[model samples]
Every structure is written in C-alpha cells, then in structure tokens.
Target: MDQVKTSIENGVLTVTVPKVEVKKPDVKPIQITGKPTLSTNFEEVTWAKLKSAICAIFLKQPDSCDLEKLYQAVSDLCIYKMAGNLYQRIEMECEAHISTALQSLVGQSPYLVVFLSLVERCWQDLCDQILMIQGISLYLDRTYVKQTANVRSLWDMGLQLFH
Candidate 1:
C-alpha cells in the first residue's frame, strides 16, 4: 500500500505504484461444435457403368438397360474410327442424355455424378484425336504444295501468277 507522488514547478504531476502481482497460467478445455454435413441421397456409381453408356452412345446403339449395364455393353465399340459429323452428333446426344439423367436424379441418387467426369474425359480424348488428324492433313497438304511448286515452275514462264 505504498504511495509515491511528485509535482513539477510548472505543470507536471506524477504518481507511482509500489508492487504488481502475477497469476499462474491456466488451461481451458476446447469443445467441438457440431457434426459434419453429408449428402446421403445418392449411391456411388461405378466406372464400368459410365464406360458402357459412352460406348453405347458412340456406337449408335439403343441403351435399354440401367446405366451400368448400358455402359458395359457400349464400351466395346471402336469410338476412334467414328469421327467427323457422326462423332459430333453422338457427342451432342450423349451430353444431352447424361445431363438430363443427372438432373432428374437430384436428391434421388448420386449415381449420375460419375457421368460428368466420364463425359469430360471422353470429349477430351475425341478432341485430341481430331486435332492429330487435322495436323497430319495440314502437313500432307503443305508437302504436296511444295513438291508441285517446283514442277509447275519449270513448265511456266518466269513471271507465272497461277499454276
């Protein structure tokens, strides 16, 4: 209970404390708030089902069975050989059907979730093949034009505009 005080000649006043007390540290227990939320409506669809559905669509065959069985049946078709307009038509149909199916199952089952991933993969693969073919065609076109340029030049006048 010591008290100290000082006053300045002009305008200052000061006070000091005699002692201070320190308390020991204490630990408090932590509590978790709530359970995690999970969606229980949808069943997990397998990769096999997705594969079959894609195959059926590409092959231009009917899909009568469940998605899993349809995927299995269609999976064996040679999708690579089917290109150009045919490929595009199949792709569009497949995308539409899959999207519709998935939307219809909202809160019903999670089986259609795999469709999104599978379609993306298939589309990417198809695009890659199409690009490769276009690249080859471009290379062949350039080579053919180059090879013909020399022969055509030999026959025409020095100032020939068209071959």
Candidate 2:
C-alpha cells in the first residue's frame, strides 16, 4: 500500500490522502444489503438536492418530492435536461435487459436457472449503479414490504419474476 504523506510549512500543514482504486466485481454484484459504500462527490446544495431526490425516489417516499424545487435547483445547476436524459438512459437499459431475458428463454429448468442468474445480475447491477450515484440503497421495501399484505419488494419481485 502507498503511504499518505503529511508536510508542514511555515504556518501551514498539508496532508495528502492516497486515492483508492476498486476492482471489477466477480461475475456480478448483488444487493446483498440495504446499503453499500461507494465513492462520494460534491455535497453542495444542488448535489444534495439531487441526492435527496434520488433517495426518495428509490425509497418510493410519497413526500420526498417537490417538483418546483427540483426544477429550480437542477436548472440553477444547468444539469436539468442532462440529468433527465441520463435517468432515461438508465431506465431504458434496465428495461431492455429484462425484456431480453424474458424473450430469449422458454421457461425450462436450465433456462430458468439462467434467467435467475440474470435477475441476480440485474439486482446487483441496479444496487451497484444506484449506490454509486446515491451512495445509499434507501431500502424502500424494508419497512413496508415486510409489513404490507399486497406489496412485493424489488428483491421479492425480481425472484418471483424469474422463478
């Protein structure tokens, strides 16, 4: 491991932290837990608002949105349209993957296993990608899914879909 260095000048002290690198995950990643650590970026108000919105959206929180504020904050940052495009791209990719799996398999035992594996990959990829951006799983299903009579959590839904 590389060492972090600290230096002192006339009236100032400087500390340097080495950047850590991440390796590609084996096979794929899964949402094994409610939260996984990821690299974090700027915490300015705009980023904070976006992050909060992301958390709320993931959690399916009813009051987590204030569209007017979201518009203002995103427009102020000049990333409103870009963010929308990126979000759509992500959603489209997810939907494409699901549709591909559904169309290619014929629901045989082996094919079912393969499909389950894909679902596993999907769960992992979703967890990892979203965690990379939001840095939290926001586990909307934890409290409600367990207690609700008719609701299925994403994890549950993924399993049922493939099984």
Candidate 3:
C-alpha cells in the first residue's frame, strides 16, 4: 500500500516524496546569434569573409565588440562577398588577400584604436601581419618626429608664421 501526506502553510502545499537522484545529459551551449556557423568540415569559410566580418562588427559597435559579433560579421561578409566562390578552392587564397588589405589599412593609420581592435578580432596570421605593419609605423614615428616640439610651441610658431 502507498501512503501520502500533504499540508498547507502560508498559501502553499508541501508534500514528501521518495528520494531520487536524476542525472541530466551534458549539453553544449548553443550560440545562435552573432556567431559563425561554419560548415561540417570547417573548410568552407574563407579568411576574407572572416576578416571583413570582424571589421564590420568593429565599425558597428566601436565601444563594445565581442568575439560572437566578430564571428557573425565574418560569416555574413563571407556569404555576401564570396557567395559564388565560397565553396571553391579559391577560398583558400582569401586569407592572403585579407591579410594584405588589413596590413595596408593599419600601416596608413597605426594610431587608430579601431585598427588594433580589428587585428585582435582576426586570425593569428592576419594579426601578426597587422602587428608587423603597426610596429613599422611606430618606428617611423619615433625616429622622424621631433620630441621637443610641444603643442604650445607649435601654436606660437603658427601665430608668428601665419598671423
């Protein structure tokens, strides 16, 4: 025979049941939005798409950028830019092209934090290239710029020369 007892307290019902332990299956966290959804083999995504996506995310959210947005941006860019050739062997070469473009942009403006953030969002290979370009830019600035010149001094010179 089964026996059961219940009591009501503070507008609630309480009941005692047999103790049982249940194990739940381990589940992987699903990242639905703002994440790169790669193909099964992981070879379908091109580096160009990834880099552009990362850059777009940086442009969109200049202050609060994350890996998920970076990944999504890359995925979306890949789909739009290399739509027809994404599945082709040529996709493998996109990395080189992307790296060169990013390096060129960073070289043009090393002081911009956006460039650095974009590099951080990219793959290690692209990041290395960007860093190398940035280093060269910094070297040039340190070597060529006169350290003794101050903003006030420059203003005074401007007044003398122009005014």
lDDT of every predicted structure (CA atoms): 0.39, 0.49, 0.42
The segments of candidate 1 whose C-alpha lies over 4 angstroms from its true place after superposition are 1-110, 139-163
Q: Can you give the TM-score per candidate against the true fold?
A: 0.20, 0.26, 0.19
Per-residue lDDT tens digits of candidate 3, residues 60-162? 4332444454344434434454323332222233334564555655554566687766555554544443343223223222322233343222223222322
Model 3 CA deviation exceeding 4 Å by range: 4-41, 44-46, 54-66, 69-163
Best-matching candidate per lDDT: 2
The best candidate in terms of TM-score: 2
Model 2 stretches astray by more than 4 angstroms: 1-43, 79-163
What's model 1's overall lDDT? Answer: 0.39
* Candidate order (lDDT): 2, 3, 1
Give residue 138's lDDT in candidate 1 (0 to 100): 36
Query: What tens digits encode model 2's per-residue C-alpha lDDT throughout 37-154?
Result: 4334422555567656654544445435475665454444332223433333334444454455555544534676777887676566555434433222122334334555775544
For every candidate, C-alpha RMSD to the true structure in Å: 23.2, 21.8, 18.5
TM-score of 1: 0.20
lDDT of 1 by residue, 1-163 (tens): 5677566656766656567577877978878788654334211132234334445544446545464443332232212221232223333444554455445544653567676665555455444433332232233223332454433211121112111
CA displacement after TM-score superposition, residue 73 of candidate 3 (Å): 10
